[model samples]
Target chain A: MRLYFEKRKTASKKTLVIVPAVSLVISLILTGFLLLAFGVSPLQTFAAMFRGAFGSSRNFAETLVKAVPLMLTGLGVSIAFRLRFWNIGAEGQLVLGGVAATWTALFASPYIPSFLLLPAVLLSGALAGAAWAGVPALLKTRLQVDETLTTLMLNYVAILIAEGLFYGAWRDPGGMGFPGTARFPQAAWLPRLYGRVHYGLIFALILAVVLWFFIYRTKWGFELHMIGKNRTAAHYLGVNIKRTILISILISGAFSGLAGATEVAGLARRLQEGLIQGYGYTAIIVAWMAQLNPFASLLAAVLMAALLVGGDQVQMMMRLPAAVGLVMQGMILFPLLAGSLFSEYRLRVSQPHKEETS
Target chain B: MILLVQSVIAITIRAGTSLVYATIGEIYTERSGILNLGLEGMMLMGAVTAFAVAFHTGSLVLSLLIAMGMGMVLSAVHAFLCITMRANQVVSGLSITLFGTGMASFLGQRLGPAENNFYLVGLTAARFRRIAVPFLSDIPILGALFYQDILTYGMYILIPLAWFYMFKTKHGLNLRSVGESPQTADAMGISVTKIRYLYTILGGMFVSLGGAHLSLSYTPGWTENITGGRGWIVIALVIFSMWNPARAIYGALLFGGINAIQFRLQIAGAAIPAPVLNMFPYLATIAVLVLVTWWESKGKKRLGAPAALAVSYMREDK
Candidate 1:
């Protein structure tokens, strides 16, 4: 018997829900083997990870803190993805956001009113992110540059720009040689609702709702979906592909930029070494795991954040590498991508054909 | 000025060795209709694995083999997902990078001697040393190619052979046909799946070798991120070369020359900051990409890339 595939009449909506869940379980199992090979017990390690992430209010709050950036960046990425634009520079965009936020909080705070300090810092960051993303969009639309390379290359450049400032121009003089900017003013500080968790959670949640409406309930959302599914069709139908790509991508960058703003204004309190903890990269996993749905991505962000927070916990508690959590996070996508086939095609065991005769 | 120019040329060749390998590897993979963005991750894994094994075993050949094996295994996963599973090629490539990067970082942390706190960072290992060709080393500028490690010498032959294999051979035609139109290739009695799978895995071996060169020859040690975006730069070089192995050397020279100049300027204490100077290569790549893309657009069609690239062939689609 030979195996063959037939396209499904309509893509299975259920698979969209089921595949991610199944992929999670498969990842856990796969990671178990890895854990065992390293002389660690999978069950106990997983229990430790769970406890580290959600064992107490404090740990869960920290998870939420990590989840905030992931969610915002995930939302940012989904918008570009909606138009089939591969904007992998969210990491760079987020870093640039943090950089711009630092500038606004430090230099612009003197010029702006006290109450507007936070708004200005956050807005500048979002705009910086939007501007950075606009480069590749213009390149792709105007010069036809393949975005994947440009976006990926810009990430390194963005990280370097941040390094140049904190290590050089913006160095905290009083801090005695630490590579970081000075702490922000009190007005620039993000007010916290609970232990170490700031209003960024609220920003991300509100944006998630607003983005859901913008994506699903508006005429522009229809254009985005049409452009994503069939760009030729969208173009033939006069959807103005170039303009939509530029605007949507800029908005996407703004969301991720705002994520960086919240991160700096809330958690780091200054641009520093640990500010870029790969949440931008994790957001891609979050966006895909959520099937590019804004609502689902917020939830997916939490799950991924738990892995990162829990990974750190294990590093402290079990002396296991913190990268194990990353390993688990990356592992989830393999099975998910492979399993996506079932949602679009049906497998059949075809009878072997008789050898052709002359 | 003569001495400085000669030194710069020497550094260019040294640095270009790794880029040439990676560019050719990516060229081969994309030529067969597959785009693998996992080169950075693979390079990191290769560098780490090569360093760790050589540190322990003191066997260069063995370590290099294992590292290439690691790359093949990862690329095979990408192949299976994109080819058989028919997943989104872009997403599948991205995931491979993610997974490879994580695993490499994990291994770098876990696969070291306990004396160094089980970290590959800061440990010394066996590395390739430069071997100078006697008469050739006396030449003014061309001598740069003679004072090189075994890996760099390999690039000299690999570049021409790769160009010839892809453009002048029937198998190369089959490979291009598979990438340009898998359906037509299938009708022409070529197994598109086999060509794609073979080249992808084969290309991955060279990519790993490029990483191995970094640790074994250039830097000679393992850091958290040893590739430092060289893997990404290789992607741009593929475009700069217009997907031809022979033309890749000049792009490598341009980038590798930047590194030499950057190093020299830093030693001379130039007014520009190190970070700012380092941004040139990336910026230059973006500039080159725009130029090449614009130039390609002015033409009718078939600039160099396979027409059906990144599009999976199911045979039933037509």
Candidate 2:
């Protein structure tokens, strides 16, 4: 009996380990096919990409830098998804948050001290993101508007708003009429780690840990999970569904906002029209691939960040377009989804219904 | 004031060009119990294919046909995942959008940034000129309505045909029945799977028309992110119209009007911030969504979506 139990345990462990490992191997092979299509040697291209993304300390710093926004946005998506609320407008929220950060930095320049101004700017960014998210939340709660459609539509509106601000009112005066805000003050900048990577990575890590605790340990988190699992049952159990959804969305939105604020403060140090590079959208894939778990999302974010860093190398070394990364990223999600499908249902072949009946 | 009215008419016609096709396409898919979130991606594929083929061959007619074929193939991918494999429709659709957009953008970048000339070899720009009846063209304000491109007229005719086909035909009823409850349709001798596949493929063809409308009829050139968020707007418009084709036309026009006014407001130098003005269409959609839901939710007579609408069908024996 002892030997049988040990064998059973080993078999289960093998099953658990092999599934994801197999998926990774398949995705890599598919990515190799993509490289071949682009007329580059798959092994050499990937080797160069690995080297370019992690060969030197500079590349490593850049990889961490890229991971900051991705991790925050992934956390945002995973949080919302945990509550069964599909928040697909993280991109728009990031844009609005970036705009808010820029506005705060610009307007608060003379009055606030450097130390005080930075936190305030970041706070404003979070507020703006939440408020931007509040529109769809209100519509969904009050009027029963579909959050999915509203959030998706609002992204374009947010893009236009950001464009309008940079092109019209926020154009820098002394910077040759460029369509961007003035450089942020030194006080507005985020503190860097080792003077290379910004403190955004630290913030994202801390936030991830906090989110992990809240999701797996806290009472409110339990309530959110209950509602997510079943809205009607949670309602009967005395949980306020609308309030939970609002709070869930607000928290998610704030994370995305902080991501944008970090980008402004840590990387750009100013608002540009193209500040966000679709990190919000890409986070959707990361969150889903991680099955909406916060800790899992952290690892997923790192993997995605590595891909982005590698994509740049693919462009520079292999003369491949950067969008090749996008294709690979996109293709990975398909098989990732297919893998998850097996977790839910087991496939079985059967004869035709007539023959079965006979 | 005249220019404003004219711009309203012009923009309404222009905006309706894409929305008309998308709304109808979504109507077909939703009626068959599949919420194709990949409509945006299909439209992008349509736009790219239309532009690429039209640029190379310089044949507008063949370009539209190719666009339809491209959309059919892309939509087939969604159908394969959703119907055959029974995957999550939303996830599959999202994946298609990501894949389509990435692929299109990658190809567009390779093709370079300059606009490819897509004019017919023999026909000039006048070949697409508006046609107006003598009596109707003389009518005030309504006169502007009488003049339209050939595609606009196609949409005008298509709206009624769609409504008739959806409500009056046997296949339409079967599709709707499947949408309402695929199990019920399965019990009633209708092939739910076959209906879904047919309608999904047909829906894709219609959405490709929207994409072709952008490249061939409306925008007249290839640009990155060309369809913008119009596809999403059409999705919202579908719900706002309660999946009715006739209502979708007016919704499309209303959205187009808002779009035109925003551009005009920018040009006229309205005192309101352009950002705020540019926000009008989306804000208007939010308002419309709220109002429609409120209107539908009143008197305990709910006008909810079809119950089985986004759910995958599992043919499990009891």
Candidate 3:
């Protein structure tokens, strides 16, 4: 007997949803085994995680707070991925955004009027992210450098640049020599929506709807998808491949930058080493899980945020290390990737000799 | 100043060994049509596993073996995802790194240093000690290179052997063909899937060996993120060397020298801020990548990249 995969003529929508659900269940089972290996009860640990993320209103709010950056970054990554542009440097771009926001809040805000302060800071952050993303995009278009490698290399450079500033000129003088910038003034702080959640939630939600309109509703969005599916085909259809790619990457970087900027303005209120907590990277997974849909990315981001917040609970309550969340997140992607195969193809069993004879 | 130069050179060779191992490993994997971005995670896993095993069993050989085995196992997951399932290689590789790093960190928390500065306990006995070669150790300026650990010496042999195997052997040609044009290789009766899986796993073992070398010889202690972007540097080095194993040695030395100088400057109380000094290697890597990429494009060189690189093969795909 032999088994092989046959391509489906048309994918079933039911399978599309069910496969990922199956993958998630399998991943959870695998993670349960890992928890067992660590001498923890998977059931109680999961319950604790659920409670930590959503049991209380405040906990749910914290989960949303975490989801804010993930959503923004996820949207950013989805934009680039749609163009077949691998922008792995979202982390660095996000950090650079934070740096730009810090510059605005620290220097420009004190000089500008109160009304202009927030917009200037946010705009600077997004522009900074776009600028950082421009390097790899230019290289890809002009020199044919692989953006995956170049973007990743730039991530370290961005982090180092942030570290350099924080440890040097940006170090708070009055705060006992800590390696972080001075706090943002009241005008610069993003107004909280209750608990720790901030206005970034609104920004992310509005952007998601706008992006959904842009990607699925607009002609330019169709061109982006066309290029992603096939560059030659897109060119034949009059899509300016190079210009579209460059613009898409810039927009992608802007979204990631906004994520970083909002993170600092809304939560941290200061640029520091921890400003980038892998939210940008997590956004990659979230974007993939969302199938690059803007609104789906919002849902995916919330789910990922729950995992992250719940991981922390497992660490505190179950005495497991905080790295457990990372492990779970990583494990989830594999099965998800594997399960996606079922969407495009189905398995068939046959006897080789009998087929040939027939 | 001469003594300082000699010591720095010595440290460069020692530090460069792990990078050389990793670069060669990646070269091997990429040559077989897959790019494993999980080098960092795999290395971290190897480092932590070696440290844990050595801490418990106190057997250097066993620890090294287990580390390599662990790396192979991780890469096998990558192979299954990339080859069998036809998953996006970049996402799969990143996922592997994330999973490996997370698992390593989780395990490290359990087996790592009980307190700061106390990580070296029981590790020193299993650590690779420098062995001086007769008459070779007496050579001036280069004498320190002749006296090094077993892993460094093994690398000296492995580099040349890898080059020979990749260039001069029949299997090497088959592997290259698979990477360059998997469909053609498949039509010509070569098993593209088999070659890919074999080389990726083999490449993973070498990468893990480099990680074990870090824990067992160079640093002799496990720390969170012990590889510290070295895996990414190796990725850059593979490009800088234009996928040539022989050329990778120079790339490794250049990076290793920068790392050594950073430490020396800090120790010497250089006036430069420590953070700026620390950025030297990463900045240099970016510079090297850009320069090499530009040079390759300008010269109209073949770029030496396997044509089918990163493309998953399916037998029935049009």
Q: What is the C-alpha local distance difference test score of each model?
A: 0.88, 0.76, 0.87
Q: Per-residue lDDT tens digits of candidate 1, residues A131-189?
A: 98999999998887888778878888899999999999999999787789999999999
lDDT, residue A181, candidate 2 = 81
For model 1, residues B1-318, the per-residue Cα lDDT tens digits are 877888999998998888899899989999999988878877877888999899999999998998898888888988999899998777787777777777888888888898877888888888899999999998987787798999999999999999999999999999999988898899999999999999999888889888989989899988877887787788878877878889999889888988898889988988888788778778877887787778778885556767777888887766
Candidate 1 global lDDT: 0.88
Q: Please provide, for model 2 over B1-318, each residue's C-alpha lDDT reduced to its tens digit, 9 standing for 90 to 100.
A: 775686578767877878888889988888788888877777877877777677667777877788888778877877877876666677777877777777666666554333432221222121234678679867766677768777788888899999999889987788889998899999999988888888888988888778878866677666767888676777777876777777778778877877777787778877777567657666766677677667777855545356577777766532
Off by over 4 Å in 2: A1-52, A109-111, A138-143, A194-196, A232-240, A351-358, B1-4, B110-148, B262-272, B299-304
| Model 3 Cα lDDT, one tens digit per residue, B135-217 | 99778878878889999999989989999999999999999999999989999999999999999999999999999999889
Docking class of 2: acceptable
Instruction: Residues A127-156, candidate 3: write the lDDT tens digits.
Output: 999999999999899878788888887887
Angstrom error of the Cα, residue B288, model 2: value is: 2.2
- How big an interface RMSD has model 3? 1.9
Top candidate, metric DockQ: 1
Q: iRMSD (Å) of candidate 2?
A: 2.2
Report the alpha-carbon TM-score of model 1 versus the true structure: 0.95
How many clashing pairs in candidate 3?
A: 0
